[model samples]
Target: MIEVSKGIYWVGAIDWEIRDFHGYATPKGTTYNAYLIVDEKVALVDTVKEPFRDELLSRVGEIVDPAKIDYVIVNHLERDHFGSFAQVMDVAKNAKVYASGRGKKGIEEVYGERWDVTAVKTGDTLGLGKRTLRFVETPMLHWPDSMFTYVEPDRVLISSDAFGQHVAGSQRFDREADPHALMEDAKTYYANILMPFGTLIQGLLAKVPSLNLAPEIIAPDHGLIWTKPGTIIDAYGRWSKFEARDKVVIAYDTMWESTGKMAHLIARGAIDGGVEVKLFHLRKSPYSEAVTEIQDAKAFIIGSPTLNNGLFPTVGGFLYYLKGLKPKHKIATAFGSYGWMGGAVKEIVARLKEMELELAEPALDLRYPVTKQQEQECIEFGRKIAKQVKEAKQ
Candidate 1:
């Protein structure tokens, strides 16, 4: 409940263990972020998780009488952002709840009609004495009603979750964290959550810049606030453009030791070729986690062992979900082990194409037990991917 700036307060979870988020099956702890802006008119940007309701109330009290708060801006309809709305009403009964048209029903479905819920459109402004919050509708940002709130005087943008990560901590700003840790945290968040919405993100980035509004603070619903402003703007520009990394995501679903061996050496080949690599055993790694890690990589390689005359169900499921999001602008390849029913390779290749990734080469499909020849093929595949990444200068 501490104030992060003159009149801005941090009211989000600071859990160190929440690595996963969005009900997306994350392996990392996540924060349900909220903010309180005390100005000519008191405005609260979203609310915390249910248990944190009292804390939110206490914080608002510190700024002024809760009843003095003129508006409660609902940036995202997800429960993590509005779970405490009921509690808030008890204090600020007259406060109006602002949300996009798409979010109103979601909130109604969750909380029912209990207060003034105004469904606004893009570019709607709410003036509260000296402060004005302009709302921007950004649908399909993982949700139909996701929105961004811009505070005029402070030049603060409450970008619900657009540039946010699932980083867990009490650190309010990235400047306080280790740079490497912050990068990983931010990267993972973008990959897992924002990857599927790449096109929408790109559009939003362009739209915001044209608005010519420079935000000194980008207070997202999760992770650190962008106090440096351009820091995250630059990051969003790079990530939304699918900026390539000198890395590859070697995501696999292995059976027996055959496919496992291939994944290990392929990663080695990539490393030897001077490319960074991340290996995620699909069975052990959640798709959300892998997606986040894959976001910045210049290339993607998926390996799976054949089962039931088809690709492993998990691998198939991941592709189906990822396809819906339409991740693109990267080179991709496939590799895996098979027995009599050698269908994994074809299935993987098809899935990669489904995501519209630029095909690299014919998949290196291996037969079971991985003959010495097949193992060497895995190494060559890694080398090829490395060379491709290096050549791409990602």
Candidate 2:
């Protein structure tokens, strides 16, 4: 067990083999992190998934008996974080449960009211002799019941899900992990899970500074803890604002080689026009990974071949996922190939429009095998888009 503070130990389990999390790919696995603080009243920050309850209990047992636990904090009511709450309370029967008002209601809705949970609001503090535990409500920072627990004296914020990554490893802090990979996972997490709540995140960030809570460390529910809180706080500020770079992402799926060839030619034109680009075959690449690329890109170009009267199933799935993510301040366009009925490009265009992205151009479609003239047209279309991206106001 890693000691984050003098009296606080990380008592969480790492899922080394989990390949997927809530439908998102978790190739690197993840950690269901919880913290144990030994003060006048022993407090548990959070708990693990239901399957990992034994692991959490074992870790907590190393420092103190489970019966000694006096308080259990529920930062978020999601199953991943709250699945083992019942088990913890069952063992530490004397421990009083604490959660935000909404969190308490959500927990009751899911697990019934066998145990009495004290509902707290923003700015509420619980004294534990030497240190103070303060609650901050963060609704829709991914979930309505999400809240942050600030442990004073230690100056640590037990941030629930915010500023977290799906990384399972021996390291317990961001400094111990590969910074590049950790940041990449953090970006992917933000893109897939938290992008839709951009406004709420921004509001949370602005609210934190005014509270004057200078957190020295940020302990999140997943991934390594952030010892240097400034790094992640700065990142959240930028990401919450939907700040993007001068890059384009071209995502597409192909049946034969027609649509694939167009994707390559278009990528080539964008490169020749001095615009940074990322190209991914949706079926080959994880949709979550593509969403990560799209997060900070100024433009997205989609290509798919028509199947029956609609988009390719893989393409449709990717678009559906991307649309739900609600990427903002992006320009989009579509290109595809069809055999008899040309409908894929139109459908892709409509999906991008539904996402509220600025339509960079009308959809481009080709019948059967793409001709040399059509390839050239695709190239010009890419160049035109590059010009638009270059001229876009930062």
Q: Show the colliding residue pairs in model 2.
A: none
- TM per candidate comes to 0.90, 0.98
Compared with the true structure, the alpha-carbon lDDT of candidate 1 equals 0.79
| Candidate 2 per-residue C-alpha lDDT over 46-142 given as tens digits, one digit per residue, 9 for 90 to 100 | 8999999999999999999998999999998887888999999999989988998898898788778877899998889998879889998887777
The models' CA-based lDDT, in order, is 0.79, 0.89
Compose the digit string of candidate 1's lDDT tens values, residues 245-291: 78889888876868889999899889888999999888887887677
> Which candidate tops lDDT?
2
- What is the Å distance of residue 354 in model 2 from its true position? 1.5
Per-residue lDDT, model 2, residue 345, is 93
